[model samples]
Target: MALATLGVVVPGIAAFYEFVVKGRKRLGYRVQMDTTATNVVETDDPGVFDQLREPLVDPTLVLLRIENNGQTHIDEDDYAVLHDKKAGVTITFPDRKVVGMVVTELSDDGMRSSFEDGGGLAVKGSRILLPKVPMNRGAHYKVLAALDTMNGKMDQYPPPKVACTIKGGVTGGKIQETRSRTGTPKRVIALIVFLVAIVVAQLVVFTQSNNGAPLDCASGHLNVTGSTAFAPIAREAAKSYQDLCPDATFGFDMRGSGEGLQFLDQAGRDGKADGQLTFSDGEKPDDMPGLLPRPIAFFLFTLVVNKDSGVADLTGDQIERIYQGKITNWRAVGGNDLAIRLISRNPGSGTRNAFQRRVLGGVREPGTNSDDCRNRDPGSPPGVVRCARDSTDAVLRTVESTPGAMGYSELGAATGRAGLTAIRIDGHPATVDEADHGAYPFWETEFGYTAGEPAANSLAASFLRYLTNQVGADIIRSYGDRPCAELANPQLCRPT
Candidate 1:
């Protein structure tokens, strides 16, 4: 009788353990932004919902999707071991500076909020594990790991950095794999193993801090330069393309478009133009000849003022007068009764050229940046627009700091800066929709030009091809430049 009872008990225990405790529970992860998806929040404010495509207003969060590819289920309590890491996302910039989310916005759908409220879609706490949620085999769960747009550190046409690690499993004595922790000794060992796992992950991260640092490739170095306007975009593209072709590396110089065209011309003269690539935020000059024009992205210049200016929209004609030193007071354009400070860029700025031609009726404005900004007559208060910054960064800072100050920038360069407001032109704001509908007029077409045409197998050609495709276009859009596809509306344009 005793022997029979032992046999029955042992078999029963083994069967129970096989089905309940040691079932396989492996997980795989993907970090993706659902570009096709948009989460719109409605409020009493009129027309806010209608203009969801205002570039910065879209609140699509980046999702860290966890898929249970195991044979067993994973309860929420078992999976809640997800915290203890930084915001669950890691963003490395072109300069290899790593920035983690300091604002712990770990939240989810139930904790929904808008971009205005910093209501991004991060999952809030391990609280979502309260009811012991189950992750069945082949099932998926998504948590908001990061917001689409983060302020401060990320400003002006930033690149996409999608490097992250998502680790999930049971904690404590519950061995997630097919290992048994049924005894006091085993449980103690399991706990030790857990601590070691945590240490190893941290060690791997710190041990190789310089593992993927951007390379200064001199061997197969691909030098690209031009347009400070497009320099930010080029920097990002260089990083991404390096990831694609590890053998091909890049150097980007943010000299103005004039320099870009000049460099290409020199390269052409030396018969080494095959080794160069250049980009610009404006059209190719007639003298900068022999360059194939491959439009990479669409960029726009927007009139902007300090947020305190109380001025919001400006017609083309009014903007023309302001830049031409005609209109000199805020009250002249329905704002405070302060002097209308005319801000201009240094001489030969491509932005200035475009503005002068399109809005200022091609007439170059008088006064050097210093000369115009000079103290005016006490009686007149303000007059000709003066004050110029050689760089866009300086321009943005100048505009934001000055009261009643107005200036212009490539839409991307101006978007994320604080204390600055991009005024609408003719009641239409710069947006993808406005660009598509042709309502927001006169956007500069960005071009990537090689000395001649790049060969099919050439590195420059490959990079240019990448830029003109759907994926490349998406990356460009991520940088705040309108992809050529929007203009290609019924037609998708690819590099020849």
Candidate 2:
């Protein structure tokens, strides 16, 4: 009986060893790697992963293909967030000394990263990317990875290591790259006569406001768009730039800063320029490939409520809870007995993004980004957060009309507007004077972005260059935000 039992147990153990251990080995032995063909860029296209912190990094896509060439089937799983949740895989770049790779999957559209959603999974043989790594152009890299599974063991992110190299990219030729004569000799003769008459009628209206400055430009047009927070400054700066180069025209209208970055992305990525949007202003975006951000000024976002509400102040903790939907009543926060009506901006709005990030500390505000706004409502009976308005004036009016309504907006937008009262956060009054001097805690730098450095002769490039000058500084201050002329804080400092 003992011999019979020993024979059965011994065979089972050997079979298990052959199936598991040998299978992983064979899988690793037969792995392969494949990379897509691409080119290096001449112009510097900068991008940032952590908008509020990280330095600019160029966007370089790296895709790796892993296959099973072994005689055995090696079961595997590749999921960045899920893998981490279930005891993730071990990956490394010996050349860069980066270990523990967190692989992410594509979005439903398969056009974006699921890093935010934290959902990427793979089984058996598949292809994966080097989850948004900043790599130097015109260079080679060695990547290695490993993983664990239910049925069998795993090795490396794709099994065997691969060394890949990158080269420079090329662009198409510009349209009408040279000059051409448009008029005939007879037309030119008439043009010369017309020019003489124009010079005789030309009168210089020199006012003290001009300060002896004259319209001194040739001819060109540029559109400045996005970031209503910075619109005043940008619009005013257009006048200043025109003072130096009057032949050039600039367009800046009312639009959210977040939408401005999208304009830049569309222009940079698809090479399609908007008829009236040449530059975009706002907080820098996370992915900034083929672009650069210049921090020009600083501004604050203030919390405001209907003047009729009895609430005057709130602690940071209480304010956070209010947005979290934990404290649903105005009375709960020392206000009149009323249901707190939460008013919020769209996710695409730059002001909303700043308020959420700075005030909520990355926590989702209740009733925002959900079937409504977030996940839950912050009212007494639990209701969807209401849209205040896209325009600052409109938002202020909405809050004033709706009793118990509270919302956030740029300090400049709420100030001087009737029927709205700005609330103090943590005993600190939200004001431009306080925020500019760093007395207030809630403020963010205004950013302008472009596709690398603009061409030397391009008016858009010239305008950006002028934006850093003293004239630009003066114009930025005229807006609600303070232009950081001499500041040590990186957020306020000008980006090189």
Candidate 3:
């Protein structure tokens, strides 16, 4: 029995040695190195690794069939690939040392069998396999392999070391060339769009700035139109105001007072005029629209004659008779025997309205041959030796130069002229003090009109306010006109 047990043990030991050791010797393996197309390869003058050192590397998967060059069969389940870091790996070379081999695994049925490079159990009729590895262009890599048996026996073999240089940094070079050719057009388009955006933003800012101070008038012009009699006074006030507000501009035009009302109407419809001046003929005209009534000064319409004429005063009835052609000769009104030359404003003038209302009782019919003694009509009239002047200046000149002539003008123009004398009206002297106190009977107010609310309170409005103030009253008095108290507040002009 002892002899039989010894025989069984010996056979078992002998079988294990043959299958695990001798069988593994027949399987030979080696490693190969290749360079990628994109990177440069540099090596030290002296070798950096010995044949006995284990190769350290980053191994990429490859797809290839490894033919069984010896008589062995490789198993599929006996291997794995490992890395210093499991997910991905990097290999660093210090001082550009010469590289040995990059380690990788081999498999029997296209699957890795062990972590060692070129490791596999092979049969003479079978082959091992690997998957392809990808690399950067011009990059160099080293590779090696090893073999192992399941029973702990292992062997490593070094393949011939070879060197190769990559010709170009292929991927990086292509990217740089593409950028160089296409950059200018894109940059120009971007710059144009940026500039356009900047201009639009600046315009928006300018508009907002103007909107904040629309009424300041620091950079604008204002225009006033209407009553010729009021034109000089308004112009003087505007000039004085301009001295205080240098950035503001002002202008005026004298059409007749009726036309002034029409201009007010037009301003209401189209925003044309900034102000209007008209005489009060007892009531405001219902036909005029959008008028903003404000009293700026008082004008007394007095009959003026050449200083050489002997006439100094006329009763209301005498003046009516003269305008009606009842008293054509100057001798009738205590003047020279010369013919009484009449200078009158145009028919549409508010001055004409005021004259007719006060003296002729609104009678305006033209006399027949300066002999008709009746007030036939109040809208049309004739005078002997009529000088049809549209403005106060013309009326004054006609009265001053013509012998035995009489015409009406505001007190301002009637005074200080060498050749004209103002006549007394209804036993009351036509004086600025009388007009200011309302005792002179021809006091009236002026107005400015606008459409709805103005776009904003404007410089024109400021000027109007100034014209009503005390300083403005002094200016008015200087011009031979009464201050605006009677027109502004009749109560203020009541007798003391």
Candidate 4:
């Protein structure tokens, strides 16, 4: 009875093993495998070795080998890392497709294989001793092995290809081969050439447009030189005009009215410039060329003081006294007892010239008895405070910092300084509206100067039209300047 039981148990165990091993093969179930094919395989069918190949999907590892072929030792810096040392490889596929891939490597016994995100396609280390587990069969594959260096220098390498096969008891395997693609380099070169041609063409267009017909009503580059007071308004106007006519450009220089007139006078005689605008107080200079044209825009010069000076207004006579070195203390002007520190422009300033002509009536000298003025002349009379600043920004800086300091500046510059206050002139507030309506006592027009009538219908004319337009006016106002139309008595042409 014991012997019979043992025989029955042994047969049953053998049958169970056979069923587990061969069940899927007999049923003809296909197994989808990973790229390495190292994982155990399973099947629904009991039996079937017939394999179908799926195209090798996107690869993760691409090995590249670069060879110098020359005998020179290459430095490490000569080679650039791929993707800036990030984990990507460059490769060519068996189908001649080129791609950069990311992959993982596994090694055993001095042999290596790579795995990527794609389906089960892998390169085995040794073919004879270690047959590849089959992926879906018949798929083509190519893999770059690794980056290699010649003479200690790293470089790129061509990839290797492999075909899938199954033989004998081995259900899957990979075969190594080579692949080549034609015309790829030529295509890349052609693309680069096309891009370069486009860039050159654009450059030519830009150059031609910039150098086009001068000032022919189309608006070319206009050189504007005159009062710094007018510079902000003119600059804003030029920019606005350029926006309207993109091809036109304007150049402005903030030379004083005298310098502008001088340039215009010279250019007029030499037939160089087209128009002239002078911001003089209508006391036209004797030497000013009769041919030069007149003003275009009027601007005002006003006295600006420290906001804490407690002075809000001044009469012309009081201003004369303050600038002439009469009033040395703010208390005299209804303010605290701080010593008045007066600031004035350089003698050559158009603003200075205009102030002398209008406010001083050309009689009172600036350096008379005022501590603010320092005498360059040995026997000169006492002078007003000589700030000797170069630009409006400089003058404002002094006024804002020096307690009880008073200076004259363009209304635009004085508008927003923290410590500065603009005084009402003769009871009328210094404002854009007042200046526009001619109510502001300090209001005046600015001018541009050119030699002759601008070349018929040139860029100069276009620029002038643009300056007078609503758009340009809007920009001027935005910059704390009254627009040209606003300065007009009727004030009808409002900025749009």
Report the C-alpha displacement of residue 1, candidate 4, in angstroms. 99
Better of 1 and 4 by lDDT: 1
> Per-model C-alpha lDDT, please?
0.58, 0.51, 0.49, 0.49
Instruction: Give the TM-score (vs. native) of candidate 1.
Output: 0.54
lDDT of 3 at 343: 76
The regions of model 2 sitting more than 4 angstroms off are 1-219, 273-282, 368-381, 431-439, 488-491, 494-496
- Backbone clashes under 3 angstroms, per model: 7, 21, 29, 59
What's the residue-level lDDT of 61 in candidate 4?
Answer: 25
Alpha carbon lDDT at 103, candidate 1: 21
Tell me each candidate's TM-score. 0.54, 0.50, 0.49, 0.49
Per-residue CA lDDT of candidate 4, range 1-496, in tens? 8899989998888765544422211101111111211113666642111121211122112332222121122222222232122111122233223221222122221212213211123222211011122222222222222111222322322333322221211231112232223223445434433443343344335435645332223645667776777777777777766655676676666666666677667776776665333333233366664533434544656889887688989888888888777887789978887777777776667777766766676754455233333223355444444455656777788888877888888777788777888888778886667766656656555544445566546766555555554445445555555434434463322211
* Whole-model lDDT, model 3: 0.49
Model 4 spans > 4 angstroms off:
1-219, 274-284, 362-365, 368-384, 432-439, 479-496
Model 2 Cα lDDT, one tens digit per residue, 202-280: 3212322344444323248876767766676677778877777667887666577667777777787886553334333
List the candidates ranked by TM-score, beginning with the highest: 1, 2, 4, 3
Between candidates 1 and 3, name the one with more favorable TM-score: 1
Best by lDDT: 1
